[model samples]
Target chain A: MSHMFRLLETGFNPAVFNMGLDEALLRSVAQGESHPTLRFYGWKPPAVSIGYFQGLHEEIDTDACAAQGVDIVRRITGGGAVFHHYEVTYSIVVPLAHPLARENILDSYRLFLGGIIKGLATLGIPSEFSPINDISTGGKKISGNAQTRKLGCILQHGTILLDVEVDQMFSLLKVPLEKARGKLIADIKSRVTSVKHCLPSAGSEPFESLFSTTVGALEKGFAKSLDLDLQRSEPTLKELEIAAELAAGKFASAAWTALR
Target chain B: MKLELIGKPEGCKLLRLTIEIDATAGLSAMALIQSISIRGDFFAIPEEEFDALERALAGVALGKLGLEFSKLARERGLQCAGISGEGLDEIVHRHLATLNERN
Candidate 1:
């Protein structure tokens, strides 16, 4: 049986607005006003998103982030800090009782990430869904994901790395120990891989085309692998209004970002 | 006493705990937890339930922190990933034992 899904390609948005829109879509799907959704988006001005349970000051160098014109926000989902740049971010919202849902966290990730794995394959990159919220190619991580279940729906969001700038990432994020920063940076460089690095002709292709190219590949990958009838759509006016409020009121608020 | 401890159980992510201990009968008395903030890259579904777990840990004796935390987490049915009650129990108890050695 083919499931119906709303596909929204909301190109670029501020960090708070991006997070708010994801939550807003989750709420709408849970309330039965909209279909389960698969949305692809990008962050404007770049950004750093920390996990819900993480301490803001512990993970981020706010002064550096602001100085570099990067936005910062706390995700409702729990995971490590993520530098949102040179990546194609995707969010999938599905009801708890949906066929794709799993009771076990690891099993849920295995099932939900099948599309990503298949999508990577479509791009000529064979990837596996690494346990505990990651997608890996070979042994290096290519993507990181975070998920939260609320209001009878599961909202899983993640980033697919198109390119990586490990040094810039380290500059924006604080290490566990200042002295170990060099070692940590070296370790991340070895352990992380990206689409541009993996794809044969990706380097020659214009950087601007990577986003659309990857998004298109992923859209087809999800539809074929997940057995979905996806209809192109826009964010409903109600969703946009609610997202704007959430952006200003929750995601952008200091109390919420510094919640831990 | 303000105590900060870091633990990383075999199968869980790094857990950083900033705890305030209130000793009821002076330094030698039973140490009770004034408050605890659990921070890490762990996943707990319906995060509010996890927040409630933080609140529910109040006044729990330092010795029983693990038991109480495990019990409350199980009761709340917070689906967790990268962290576990047993892992937390082992981490807290092990850290305390290390603290005892310092004195």
Candidate 2:
């Protein structure tokens, strides 16, 4: 008997909907309601998701989010605020006893980051996995990841930058104004690079094209590394229902928004 | 009365502290004073010296004794600064006032 892996490429869903789907998939996997899966998703409305331990009032400008119609949500995992835009996000859920699960947290991050590194290589972007789970190009961060484990399963998700509005991000975040001024802000800008920044001559690839290319590369890399075929599929009915429930009860709630 | 230092020794230019209210108020009634700036004109010091300084300062309570130690650091040419965090002073004072409630 061989393990089955499914690749769900749900492109450009609303932030709440995508978070709901990830939770739903994790639940189904834990309950044995669905097979272990890898899901690639994107945000349509463009939002900032803070880590579970992060304080919304401390990390985000709620007024700015509301005024811009950006959905503010908390992730199940732990990390700082991630501005999700012009990026490809991946979520992987696997049983706790799986080989990948036996590895230490950093080891597991490296394993998944390996696939991402390979994917970026295919796009002519030579990348390296930095300590503490960030992918960088020439010392500038291009991606960030976070993970959570529950009920015999682990869900890891990460973001790859294609293009980002650095100035807008600085404005919307709650970082100290002094930190965002002059040299400090310029230092941060220098340390964070986008794919568009890397490929100035190409005039930035279309989002759809970038999505397809990156997903195809990731699927191929994972298949090669795991020695398994990644069958493309959609969420089962039960998974969809569970995701809807999580979205309504948790991801879309004020309690969750205000949680630290 | 004693104080416990809790923070990384490096990357901490000024020590920010929080004094939580608890029943063991008198047992931990020390004001925390941090180095405003490390003096001696050395970029880094020996780990053993740093650790010794930390251990020596661990349980010193606030008062004349604490002020005397700060003066000594200045005389020894060590630069340091400190400030309390939000609600820390209020919490500490509240705990001290309620010491009678703790039997």
Model 2 TM-score (2 dp): 0.71
Q: Ignoring the other chain, what TM-score does chain B have in each prediction?
A: 0.85, 0.30
Which CAPRI category fits model 1?
A: medium
**Largest TM-score belongs to which candidate?**
1
Q: Where in model 1 is the C-alpha error above 4 Å? A: A177-186, B24-30
Tens digits of per-residue lDDT, candidate 1, A191-246, equal 78899999978987775699999998899888988898999999999999999999
Predicted structure with the largest lDDT when compared to the true one: 1
- Clashing residue pairs in candidate 2 are B35-B80, B35-B81, B36-B80, B36-B81
Clashing pairs in 1: none
Give the alpha carbon lDDT tens digit for every residue of A1-260 in model 2. 34587889887877777889998888888898777898888898989997664557767898888888777888876656888878889998988876656435667778777878877777778899885668999878898887766676878888888787888787677653333342244566676887777767435668778767777777776666555457789999888888788888889999987754
Candidate 2 contains a number of clashing pairs equal to 4
State in Å the error of residue B13, model 1. 1.1
